[model samples]
Target: MSVSVDSPFVHKVWNDSELSKMVDGGVQFPMLSDQGGKIGTLYGIYDEEGGVETRGRFIIDPDGIVQGFEVLTPPVGRNVDESVRQVKAFQLVRESEGSEATPSGWQPGKKTLKPGPDLVGNVWKEWSVKDNYDK
Candidate 1:
Protein backbone atom coordinates (compact mmCIF):
# COMPACT_ATOMS: atom_id res chain seq x y z
CA MET A 1 0.00 0.00 0.00
CA SER A 2 1.09 3.57 -0.68
CA VAL A 3 0.01 6.84 0.91
CA SER A 4 0.66 10.34 -0.31
CA VAL A 5 -0.73 13.86 -0.01
CA ASP A 6 -1.86 13.68 -3.64
CA SER A 7 -5.58 13.40 -4.11
CA PRO A 8 -7.16 10.22 -5.39
CA PHE A 9 -7.62 11.80 -8.79
CA VAL A 10 -3.92 12.59 -9.02
CA HIS A 11 -3.13 9.05 -8.02
CA LYS A 12 -5.42 7.81 -10.78
CA VAL A 13 -3.82 10.06 -13.35
CA TRP A 14 -0.31 9.11 -12.30
CA ASN A 15 -1.18 5.46 -12.30
CA ASP A 16 -2.71 5.69 -15.73
CA SER A 17 0.12 7.72 -17.16
CA GLU A 18 3.22 6.48 -15.32
CA LEU A 19 2.81 3.51 -13.00
CA SER A 20 0.98 1.38 -15.55
CA LYS A 21 4.01 1.35 -17.79
CA MET A 22 6.21 -0.01 -15.02
CA VAL A 23 3.65 -2.40 -13.58
CA ASP A 24 1.43 -4.68 -15.58
CA GLY A 25 -1.82 -3.57 -13.91
CA GLY A 26 -0.47 -0.57 -12.13
CA VAL A 27 -0.09 -1.23 -8.39
CA GLN A 28 -1.69 -4.32 -6.95
CA PHE A 29 -2.37 -2.65 -3.58
CA PRO A 30 -4.05 0.48 -2.37
CA MET A 31 -2.69 3.97 -3.15
CA LEU A 32 -4.30 6.01 -0.42
CA SER A 33 -4.61 9.77 -0.36
CA ASP A 34 -3.52 11.90 2.62
CA GLN A 35 -4.33 15.36 1.38
CA GLY A 36 -3.66 17.09 4.69
CA GLY A 37 -0.77 14.85 5.73
CA LYS A 38 -2.76 13.38 8.55
CA ILE A 39 -1.47 9.88 8.07
CA GLY A 40 1.96 11.02 6.96
CA THR A 41 2.38 13.12 10.07
CA LEU A 42 1.65 10.11 12.22
CA TYR A 43 4.40 8.24 10.44
CA GLY A 44 6.75 11.23 10.74
CA ILE A 45 7.18 11.41 6.97
CA TYR A 46 5.15 14.50 6.35
CA ASP A 47 7.05 17.59 5.34
CA GLU A 48 4.75 20.32 6.65
CA GLU A 49 6.61 23.07 4.86
CA GLY A 50 6.77 21.13 1.60
CA GLY A 51 3.24 19.87 2.10
CA VAL A 52 4.31 16.41 0.99
CA GLU A 53 5.24 13.15 2.55
CA THR A 54 8.75 11.92 2.15
CA ARG A 55 9.22 8.64 0.37
CA GLY A 56 8.83 5.86 2.92
CA ARG A 57 8.16 2.15 3.15
CA PHE A 58 6.81 0.67 6.36
CA ILE A 59 6.27 -2.96 7.26
CA ILE A 60 3.54 -3.07 9.83
CA ASP A 61 2.70 -6.38 11.37
CA PRO A 62 -0.80 -7.75 11.95
CA ASP A 63 -0.61 -6.35 15.49
CA GLY A 64 -0.36 -2.81 14.14
CA ILE A 65 3.27 -2.60 15.17
CA VAL A 66 5.88 -1.30 12.79
CA GLN A 67 8.30 -4.16 12.24
CA GLY A 68 10.48 -2.26 9.81
CA PHE A 69 10.56 1.07 8.02
CA GLU A 70 12.65 3.08 5.63
CA VAL A 71 12.35 6.76 4.86
CA LEU A 72 14.08 8.57 2.05
CA THR A 73 14.01 11.93 0.38
CA PRO A 74 11.86 12.41 -2.71
CA PRO A 75 14.87 12.48 -4.99
CA VAL A 76 15.62 8.82 -4.22
CA GLY A 77 13.25 5.93 -4.82
CA ARG A 78 12.63 3.10 -2.38
CA ASN A 79 13.75 -0.49 -3.05
CA VAL A 80 10.79 -2.82 -3.50
CA ASP A 81 12.97 -5.91 -3.49
CA GLU A 82 14.57 -4.97 -0.19
CA SER A 83 11.19 -4.19 1.29
CA VAL A 84 9.87 -7.59 0.25
CA ARG A 85 12.92 -9.27 1.69
CA GLN A 86 12.49 -7.47 5.01
CA VAL A 87 8.82 -8.42 5.14
CA LYS A 88 9.68 -12.03 4.56
CA ALA A 89 12.32 -11.86 7.27
CA PHE A 90 9.85 -10.32 9.68
CA GLN A 91 7.31 -13.02 8.92
CA LEU A 92 9.87 -15.73 9.48
CA VAL A 93 10.86 -14.29 12.83
CA ARG A 94 7.24 -13.96 13.86
CA GLU A 95 6.41 -17.49 12.75
CA SER A 96 9.33 -18.77 14.76
CA GLU A 97 8.16 -16.85 17.81
CA GLY A 98 11.35 -14.82 17.92
CA SER A 99 13.48 -17.88 18.25
CA GLU A 100 15.14 -17.24 14.93
CA ALA A 101 16.95 -14.23 13.51
CA THR A 102 17.72 -13.49 9.90
CA PRO A 103 21.25 -12.55 9.00
CA SER A 104 21.90 -9.72 6.58
CA GLY A 105 20.67 -10.37 3.03
CA TRP A 106 18.77 -13.43 4.20
CA GLN A 107 16.31 -15.05 1.80
CA PRO A 108 13.75 -17.80 2.07
CA GLY A 109 15.21 -21.25 2.93
CA LYS A 110 18.46 -19.69 4.04
CA LYS A 111 20.00 -20.62 7.36
CA THR A 112 18.75 -18.52 10.24
CA LEU A 113 20.48 -17.81 13.50
CA LYS A 114 19.13 -19.33 16.69
CA PRO A 115 19.18 -16.33 19.01
CA GLY A 116 20.01 -17.13 22.62
CA PRO A 117 22.47 -16.40 25.39
CA ASP A 118 24.82 -19.15 24.23
CA LEU A 119 24.92 -17.75 20.74
CA VAL A 120 25.76 -14.29 22.04
CA GLY A 121 29.23 -13.17 20.91
CA ASN A 122 29.60 -16.49 19.08
CA VAL A 123 27.61 -15.64 15.97
CA TRP A 124 30.73 -15.60 13.84
CA LYS A 125 31.27 -19.32 14.53
CA GLU A 126 27.72 -20.24 13.57
CA TRP A 127 26.93 -18.08 10.54
CA SER A 128 28.89 -16.25 7.92
CA VAL A 129 28.14 -13.77 5.12
CA LYS A 130 28.69 -16.61 2.65
CA ASP A 131 25.54 -18.24 4.00
CA ASN A 132 23.46 -15.50 2.43
CA TYR A 133 24.69 -16.31 -1.10
CA ASP A 134 25.25 -20.05 -0.87
CA LYS A 135 22.93 -22.49 -2.58
Candidate 2:
Protein backbone atom coordinates (compact mmCIF):
# COMPACT_ATOMS: atom_id res chain seq x y z
CA MET A 1 0.00 0.00 0.00
CA SER A 2 1.10 3.58 -0.64
CA VAL A 3 0.44 6.62 1.53
CA SER A 4 1.06 10.34 1.55
CA VAL A 5 3.43 11.97 3.97
CA ASP A 6 0.55 14.20 4.98
CA SER A 7 -2.67 13.63 6.87
CA PRO A 8 -4.34 10.25 7.47
CA PHE A 9 -0.98 8.63 6.71
CA VAL A 10 1.66 7.91 9.29
CA HIS A 11 3.56 5.19 11.11
CA LYS A 12 2.70 6.43 14.57
CA VAL A 13 1.31 4.58 17.55
CA TRP A 14 -2.24 5.56 16.68
CA ASN A 15 -1.67 4.42 13.13
CA ASP A 16 -0.10 1.20 14.36
CA SER A 17 -3.07 0.48 16.59
CA GLU A 18 -5.47 1.14 13.79
CA LEU A 19 -3.38 -0.93 11.44
CA SER A 20 -3.28 -3.72 14.00
CA LYS A 21 -7.04 -3.76 14.06
CA MET A 22 -7.05 -3.74 10.29
CA VAL A 23 -4.61 -6.62 10.38
CA ASP A 24 -6.86 -8.50 12.80
CA GLY A 25 -9.58 -7.88 10.27
CA GLY A 26 -7.12 -9.09 7.58
CA VAL A 27 -4.68 -6.47 6.24
CA GLN A 28 -0.94 -6.69 5.96
CA PHE A 29 1.77 -4.12 5.15
CA PRO A 30 5.24 -3.14 6.13
CA MET A 31 5.04 0.26 7.72
CA LEU A 32 7.56 3.07 7.26
CA SER A 33 7.88 6.50 8.81
CA ASP A 34 9.27 9.87 7.77
CA GLN A 35 9.45 10.63 11.47
CA GLY A 36 10.92 14.02 12.42
CA GLY A 37 11.43 14.65 8.72
CA LYS A 38 14.77 12.92 8.73
CA ILE A 39 14.13 10.46 5.96
CA GLY A 40 11.94 13.13 4.45
CA THR A 41 14.85 15.54 4.19
CA LEU A 42 17.10 12.90 2.69
CA TYR A 43 14.42 12.44 0.06
CA GLY A 44 13.77 16.22 -0.21
CA ILE A 45 10.35 15.88 1.44
CA TYR A 46 10.88 18.46 4.16
CA ASP A 47 8.69 21.48 4.65
CA GLU A 48 11.55 22.90 6.74
CA GLU A 49 9.73 25.42 8.90
CA GLY A 50 6.51 23.52 9.45
CA GLY A 51 8.76 20.58 10.29
CA VAL A 52 6.24 18.33 8.64
CA GLU A 53 6.54 16.61 5.32
CA THR A 54 4.09 17.99 2.82
CA ARG A 55 3.22 15.01 0.68
CA GLY A 56 5.45 12.56 -1.08
CA ARG A 57 5.52 8.94 -2.18
CA PHE A 58 8.52 6.95 -3.27
CA ILE A 59 8.82 3.39 -4.54
CA ILE A 60 12.28 2.11 -3.86
CA ASP A 61 13.96 -1.20 -4.52
CA PRO A 62 15.98 -3.33 -2.12
CA ASP A 63 19.17 -1.57 -3.23
CA GLY A 64 17.63 1.74 -2.11
CA ILE A 65 17.27 2.93 -5.69
CA VAL A 66 14.16 5.01 -6.13
CA GLN A 67 12.01 3.58 -8.88
CA GLY A 68 9.43 6.31 -8.67
CA PHE A 69 8.80 9.50 -6.70
CA GLU A 70 5.76 11.72 -6.34
CA VAL A 71 5.29 14.95 -4.43
CA LEU A 72 1.97 16.61 -3.80
CA THR A 73 0.32 19.43 -1.95
CA PRO A 74 -2.15 18.55 0.79
CA PRO A 75 -5.19 19.31 -1.37
CA VAL A 76 -4.42 16.43 -3.72
CA GLY A 77 -4.59 12.84 -2.60
CA ARG A 78 -2.27 10.02 -3.59
CA ASN A 79 -3.31 7.12 -5.82
CA VAL A 80 -3.14 3.93 -3.80
CA ASP A 81 -4.27 0.92 -5.81
CA GLU A 82 -2.22 2.19 -8.70
CA SER A 83 0.79 2.30 -6.46
CA VAL A 84 0.34 -1.34 -5.49
CA ARG A 85 -0.09 -2.11 -9.14
CA GLN A 86 3.22 -0.42 -9.80
CA VAL A 87 4.94 -2.44 -7.12
CA LYS A 88 3.75 -5.60 -8.76
CA ALA A 89 5.00 -4.30 -12.08
CA PHE A 90 8.33 -3.40 -10.57
CA GLN A 91 8.58 -6.86 -9.07
CA LEU A 92 7.94 -8.36 -12.48
CA VAL A 93 10.35 -6.09 -14.31
CA ARG A 94 13.02 -6.54 -11.71
CA GLU A 95 12.71 -10.26 -12.09
CA SER A 96 12.75 -10.00 -15.87
CA GLU A 97 15.71 -7.67 -16.41
CA GLY A 98 17.46 -9.11 -13.37
CA SER A 99 17.26 -5.62 -11.76
CA GLU A 100 15.03 -3.07 -13.49
CA ALA A 101 12.43 -0.54 -12.37
CA THR A 102 9.00 0.34 -13.65
CA PRO A 103 7.12 3.59 -13.94
CA SER A 104 4.15 4.76 -11.85
CA GLY A 105 0.90 2.76 -11.77
CA TRP A 106 2.50 -0.12 -13.63
CA GLN A 107 1.05 -3.64 -13.37
CA PRO A 108 2.28 -7.13 -13.93
CA GLY A 109 2.46 -8.82 -17.38
CA LYS A 110 2.65 -5.47 -19.19
CA LYS A 111 5.41 -4.08 -21.35
CA THR A 112 8.31 -2.94 -19.17
CA LEU A 113 10.56 -0.18 -20.45
CA LYS A 114 13.96 1.03 -19.35
CA PRO A 115 14.50 4.43 -17.75
CA GLY A 116 17.34 6.86 -18.27
CA PRO A 117 18.16 10.52 -18.77
CA ASP A 118 16.76 10.49 -22.30
CA LEU A 119 13.80 8.18 -21.63
CA VAL A 120 11.82 10.44 -19.25
CA GLY A 121 8.86 11.54 -21.37
CA ASN A 122 8.64 8.10 -22.88
CA VAL A 123 8.58 6.55 -19.45
CA TRP A 124 5.74 8.74 -18.21
CA LYS A 125 3.82 8.45 -21.44
CA GLU A 126 4.22 4.71 -21.41
CA TRP A 127 2.98 4.25 -17.85
CA SER A 128 0.58 7.14 -17.60
CA VAL A 129 -2.84 5.75 -16.74
CA LYS A 130 -6.24 7.02 -15.71
CA ASP A 131 -8.10 5.10 -13.01
CA ASN A 132 -10.10 5.62 -9.86
CA TYR A 133 -7.47 4.32 -7.50
CA ASP A 134 -9.21 5.15 -4.27
CA LYS A 135 -11.11 2.26 -2.72
Candidate 3:
Protein backbone atom coordinates (compact mmCIF):
# COMPACT_ATOMS: atom_id res chain seq x y z
CA MET A 1 0.00 0.00 0.00
CA SER A 2 2.95 2.31 0.48
CA VAL A 3 3.59 2.21 -3.26
CA SER A 4 -0.12 2.71 -4.08
CA VAL A 5 -1.13 6.31 -4.68
CA ASP A 6 -4.54 5.93 -3.02
CA SER A 7 -4.44 3.86 0.15
CA PRO A 8 -4.97 4.18 3.90
CA PHE A 9 -2.45 2.25 6.03
CA VAL A 10 1.00 1.78 4.59
CA HIS A 11 0.96 -1.80 5.86
CA LYS A 12 -1.59 -4.27 7.22
CA VAL A 13 -1.88 -7.93 8.24
CA TRP A 14 -4.77 -10.43 8.01
CA ASN A 15 -3.23 -13.23 10.07
CA ASP A 16 -4.21 -13.66 13.72
CA SER A 17 -0.76 -13.50 15.30
CA GLU A 18 0.05 -12.40 18.82
CA LEU A 19 -0.03 -8.59 18.49
CA SER A 20 2.02 -8.43 21.71
CA LYS A 21 4.85 -10.11 19.86
CA MET A 22 5.07 -6.96 17.77
CA VAL A 23 5.84 -5.01 20.95
CA ASP A 24 8.63 -7.40 21.90
CA GLY A 25 10.30 -6.52 18.62
CA GLY A 26 11.23 -2.92 17.79
CA VAL A 27 8.30 -1.62 15.71
CA GLN A 28 8.72 1.96 14.57
CA PHE A 29 5.09 2.79 15.33
CA PRO A 30 3.60 2.39 18.78
CA MET A 31 0.87 -0.25 19.01
CA LEU A 32 -1.74 -0.42 21.76
CA SER A 33 -1.31 -3.86 23.20
CA ASP A 34 -4.76 -5.14 24.09
CA GLN A 35 -3.79 -8.12 26.24
CA GLY A 36 -7.30 -9.19 27.17
CA GLY A 37 -8.72 -6.65 24.72
CA LYS A 38 -10.06 -4.27 27.37
CA ILE A 39 -9.77 -1.25 25.11
CA GLY A 40 -11.28 -3.21 22.23
CA THR A 41 -14.24 -4.08 24.43
CA LEU A 42 -14.92 -0.40 25.07
CA TYR A 43 -14.72 0.32 21.33
CA GLY A 44 -16.96 -2.69 20.66
CA ILE A 45 -14.47 -3.93 18.06
CA TYR A 46 -12.55 -6.45 20.18
CA ASP A 47 -13.20 -10.14 19.69
CA GLU A 48 -12.99 -11.61 23.20
CA GLU A 49 -13.87 -15.17 22.26
CA GLY A 50 -11.67 -15.24 19.17
CA GLY A 51 -8.83 -13.21 20.76
CA VAL A 52 -8.08 -10.89 17.86
CA GLU A 53 -8.65 -7.39 16.59
CA THR A 54 -11.39 -7.38 13.98
CA ARG A 55 -10.35 -5.65 10.78
CA GLY A 56 -12.17 -2.34 10.75
CA ARG A 57 -11.95 1.22 9.50
CA PHE A 58 -13.40 4.20 11.34
CA ILE A 59 -13.78 7.34 9.21
CA ILE A 60 -14.65 10.19 11.54
CA ASP A 61 -15.20 13.64 10.09
CA PRO A 62 -14.02 16.92 11.59
CA ASP A 63 -17.31 17.20 13.46
CA GLY A 64 -16.41 13.90 15.24
CA ILE A 65 -19.23 12.07 13.47
CA VAL A 66 -18.50 8.71 11.90
CA GLN A 67 -19.09 9.08 8.18
CA GLY A 68 -18.00 5.54 7.41
CA PHE A 69 -17.47 2.40 9.47
CA GLU A 70 -16.45 -0.96 7.99
CA VAL A 71 -15.60 -4.27 9.62
CA LEU A 72 -14.56 -7.42 7.80
CA THR A 73 -13.64 -11.01 8.55
CA PRO A 74 -9.97 -12.16 8.75
CA PRO A 75 -10.22 -14.04 5.45
CA VAL A 76 -11.46 -10.95 3.61
CA GLY A 77 -8.96 -8.17 3.05
CA ARG A 78 -10.03 -4.69 4.14
CA ASN A 79 -9.89 -2.16 1.33
CA VAL A 80 -7.56 0.48 2.75
CA ASP A 81 -7.15 1.85 -0.78
CA GLU A 82 -10.85 2.68 -0.89
CA SER A 83 -10.94 3.95 2.70
CA VAL A 84 -8.52 6.80 1.98
CA ARG A 85 -10.62 7.79 -1.01
CA GLN A 86 -13.74 7.71 1.13
CA VAL A 87 -12.17 9.97 3.77
CA LYS A 88 -11.24 12.49 1.09
CA ALA A 89 -14.70 12.29 -0.47
CA PHE A 90 -16.38 12.84 2.90
CA GLN A 91 -14.20 15.83 3.76
CA LEU A 92 -14.57 17.38 0.32
CA VAL A 93 -18.36 17.04 0.27
CA ARG A 94 -18.66 18.29 3.84
CA GLU A 95 -16.65 21.35 2.91
CA SER A 96 -18.44 22.12 -0.36
CA GLU A 97 -22.10 21.10 0.06
CA GLY A 98 -23.71 19.03 2.81
CA SER A 99 -24.75 15.53 1.64
CA GLU A 100 -24.91 11.90 2.84
CA ALA A 101 -25.22 8.33 1.63
CA THR A 102 -22.15 7.07 -0.26
CA PRO A 103 -22.96 4.52 -2.94
CA SER A 104 -21.00 1.32 -3.59
CA GLY A 105 -17.58 1.82 -5.26
CA TRP A 106 -17.70 5.51 -4.28
CA GLN A 107 -14.42 7.33 -4.80
CA PRO A 108 -12.97 10.83 -4.71
CA GLY A 109 -13.50 13.08 -7.80
CA LYS A 110 -16.29 10.70 -8.86
CA LYS A 111 -19.94 11.78 -8.85
CA THR A 112 -21.66 10.76 -5.60
CA LEU A 113 -25.39 10.23 -5.96
CA LYS A 114 -27.79 11.71 -3.44
CA PRO A 115 -30.37 9.23 -2.23
CA GLY A 116 -33.92 10.09 -3.31
CA PRO A 117 -36.46 9.25 -5.98
CA ASP A 118 -33.79 9.48 -8.68
CA LEU A 119 -31.74 6.64 -7.16
CA VAL A 120 -34.67 4.17 -7.24
CA GLY A 121 -34.59 3.95 -11.04
CA ASN A 122 -30.81 3.58 -11.03
CA VAL A 123 -30.98 0.85 -8.41
CA TRP A 124 -33.68 -0.95 -10.33
CA LYS A 125 -31.59 -0.80 -13.47
CA GLU A 126 -28.69 -2.42 -11.67
CA TRP A 127 -30.90 -5.06 -10.10
CA SER A 128 -32.17 -6.03 -13.54
CA VAL A 129 -28.74 -7.54 -14.29
CA LYS A 130 -29.44 -10.67 -12.25
CA ASP A 131 -26.78 -13.36 -12.79
CA ASN A 132 -27.67 -15.34 -9.64
CA TYR A 133 -24.56 -14.02 -7.91
CA ASP A 134 -24.15 -15.25 -4.34
CA LYS A 135 -21.93 -14.31 -1.44
Candidate 4:
Protein backbone atom coordinates (compact mmCIF):
# COMPACT_ATOMS: atom_id res chain seq x y z
CA MET A 1 0.00 0.00 0.00
CA SER A 2 1.33 3.39 -1.01
CA VAL A 3 0.03 6.67 0.35
CA SER A 4 0.50 10.14 -1.06
CA VAL A 5 -0.94 13.63 -0.74
CA ASP A 6 -2.27 13.46 -4.27
CA SER A 7 -5.91 12.84 -4.92
CA PRO A 8 -7.16 9.39 -5.93
CA PHE A 9 -8.00 10.76 -9.35
CA VAL A 10 -4.49 12.08 -9.69
CA HIS A 11 -3.18 8.69 -8.69
CA LYS A 12 -5.29 7.06 -11.36
CA VAL A 13 -3.86 9.39 -13.96
CA TRP A 14 -0.32 8.77 -12.87
CA ASN A 15 -0.85 5.03 -12.68
CA ASP A 16 -2.10 5.02 -16.22
CA SER A 17 0.78 7.12 -17.46
CA GLU A 18 4.30 6.02 -18.36
CA LEU A 19 5.74 7.43 -15.15
CA SER A 20 6.20 3.99 -13.63
CA LYS A 21 7.13 2.03 -16.71
CA MET A 22 10.47 1.00 -15.27
CA VAL A 23 8.75 -1.37 -12.88
CA ASP A 24 7.38 -4.42 -14.62
CA GLY A 25 3.58 -4.27 -14.76
CA GLY A 26 3.80 -0.73 -13.39
CA VAL A 27 2.35 0.20 -10.00
CA GLN A 28 0.23 -2.72 -8.81
CA PHE A 29 -0.25 -1.85 -5.17
CA PRO A 30 -3.12 0.09 -3.75
CA MET A 31 -2.31 3.81 -3.83
CA LEU A 32 -4.14 5.64 -1.09
CA SER A 33 -4.52 9.36 -1.52
CA ASP A 34 -4.06 11.67 1.42
CA GLN A 35 -5.65 14.66 -0.13
CA GLY A 36 -5.61 16.78 3.04
CA GLY A 37 -2.15 15.60 4.05
CA LYS A 38 -3.63 14.08 7.17
CA ILE A 39 -1.94 10.72 6.73
CA GLY A 40 1.33 12.41 5.82
CA THR A 41 1.08 14.55 8.94
CA LEU A 42 0.38 11.48 11.01
CA TYR A 43 3.43 9.81 9.48
CA GLY A 44 5.59 12.98 9.94
CA ILE A 45 6.34 13.24 6.24
CA TYR A 46 4.27 16.24 5.32
CA ASP A 47 6.04 19.55 4.85
CA GLU A 48 3.56 22.13 6.04
CA GLU A 49 5.48 25.03 4.59
CA GLY A 50 5.96 23.42 1.19
CA GLY A 51 2.52 21.82 1.03
CA VAL A 52 4.22 18.65 -0.15
CA GLU A 53 5.56 15.55 1.43
CA THR A 54 9.04 14.13 1.29
CA ARG A 55 8.96 10.66 -0.23
CA GLY A 56 7.92 8.29 2.54
CA ARG A 57 7.68 4.52 2.64
CA PHE A 58 6.31 2.75 5.69
CA ILE A 59 6.04 -0.95 6.43
CA ILE A 60 3.37 -1.61 9.00
CA ASP A 61 2.83 -4.95 10.62
CA PRO A 62 -0.42 -6.80 11.09
CA ASP A 63 -0.73 -5.33 14.61
CA GLY A 64 -0.93 -1.82 13.17
CA ILE A 65 2.57 -0.95 14.29
CA VAL A 66 5.19 0.56 12.05
CA GLN A 67 7.96 -1.94 11.53
CA GLY A 68 10.12 0.24 9.29
CA PHE A 69 10.06 3.48 7.40
CA GLU A 70 12.16 5.40 4.89
CA VAL A 71 11.85 9.05 4.08
CA LEU A 72 13.79 10.53 1.17
CA THR A 73 14.25 14.10 0.09
CA PRO A 74 12.29 15.50 -2.84
CA PRO A 75 15.15 15.07 -5.31
CA VAL A 76 15.98 11.49 -4.34
CA GLY A 77 13.73 8.72 -5.53
CA ARG A 78 12.69 6.00 -3.11
CA ASN A 79 14.17 2.50 -3.53
CA VAL A 80 11.24 0.18 -3.98
CA ASP A 81 13.51 -2.84 -4.09
CA GLU A 82 14.97 -2.02 -0.69
CA SER A 83 11.53 -1.50 0.72
CA VAL A 84 10.44 -4.91 -0.55
CA ARG A 85 13.53 -6.51 0.96
CA GLN A 86 12.81 -4.89 4.33
CA VAL A 87 9.25 -6.16 4.29
CA LYS A 88 10.49 -9.65 3.64
CA ALA A 89 13.08 -9.38 6.38
CA PHE A 90 10.52 -8.13 8.83
CA GLN A 91 8.22 -11.01 8.02
CA LEU A 92 11.05 -13.51 8.27
CA VAL A 93 12.08 -12.26 11.69
CA ARG A 94 8.50 -12.27 12.91
CA GLU A 95 8.15 -15.90 11.93
CA SER A 96 11.57 -16.93 13.26
CA GLU A 97 10.44 -17.13 16.92
CA GLY A 98 13.10 -14.58 17.91
CA SER A 99 15.81 -16.92 16.72
CA GLU A 100 16.85 -15.37 13.43
CA ALA A 101 18.10 -11.98 12.34
CA THR A 102 18.74 -10.89 8.79
CA PRO A 103 22.25 -9.65 8.20
CA SER A 104 23.28 -6.64 6.17
CA GLY A 105 22.38 -6.97 2.48
CA TRP A 106 20.19 -10.00 3.19
CA GLN A 107 17.73 -11.41 0.72
CA PRO A 108 15.54 -14.48 0.50
CA GLY A 109 17.47 -17.77 0.88
CA LYS A 110 20.51 -15.86 2.19
CA LYS A 111 22.27 -16.71 5.43
CA THR A 112 20.67 -15.22 8.56
CA LEU A 113 22.25 -14.50 11.89
CA LYS A 114 21.16 -16.50 14.90
CA PRO A 115 21.13 -13.96 17.70
CA GLY A 116 22.58 -15.21 20.99
CA PRO A 117 25.30 -14.40 23.49
CA ASP A 118 27.70 -16.45 21.39
CA LEU A 119 27.05 -14.14 18.45
CA VAL A 120 27.24 -10.97 20.51
CA GLY A 121 30.96 -10.17 20.07
CA ASN A 122 31.90 -12.64 17.34
CA VAL A 123 29.52 -11.77 14.52
CA TRP A 124 32.36 -11.49 12.05
CA LYS A 125 33.57 -14.93 13.13
CA GLU A 126 30.15 -16.52 12.69
CA TRP A 127 29.31 -14.81 9.39
CA SER A 128 31.83 -15.45 6.66
CA VAL A 129 32.40 -13.49 3.44
CA LYS A 130 32.28 -16.16 0.75
CA ASP A 131 30.31 -14.55 -2.07
CA ASN A 132 30.29 -11.27 -3.96
CA TYR A 133 27.44 -9.55 -2.12
CA ASP A 134 27.10 -6.92 -4.84
CA LYS A 135 26.25 -9.60 -7.37
Clash totals for all candidate models: 0, 0, 0, 0
Best by lDDT: 1
Pairs of colliding residues, candidate 4: none
Between prediction 2 and prediction 4, the one with superior TM-score is 4
Query: Highest TM-score among the candidates is held by which one?
Result: 1
What TM-score would candidate 2 get against the native?
0.55
lDDT of 4 at 63: 91
The residue-by-residue lDDT of candidate 1 on 47-85, one tens digit each, is 999999999788899999988788899999877888888
Instruction: In angstroms, give how far residue 25 of model 4 lies from its true place.
Output: 5.1
Candidate 4 Cα outliers beyond 4 Å, as residue runs:
19-26, 129-134
lDDT of each: 0.89, 0.65, 0.57, 0.84
Candidate 2: residue 103 Cα off by (Å): 9.1
By lDDT, is 1 or 2 better?
A: 1
lDDT accuracy of residue 101 in candidate 3: 51
Give Cα distance to truth, residue 75, candidate 3, Å. 2.2
**TM-score for all predictions?**
0.90, 0.55, 0.54, 0.85
lDDT of 1: 0.89
Ranking by TM-score: 1, 4, 2, 3
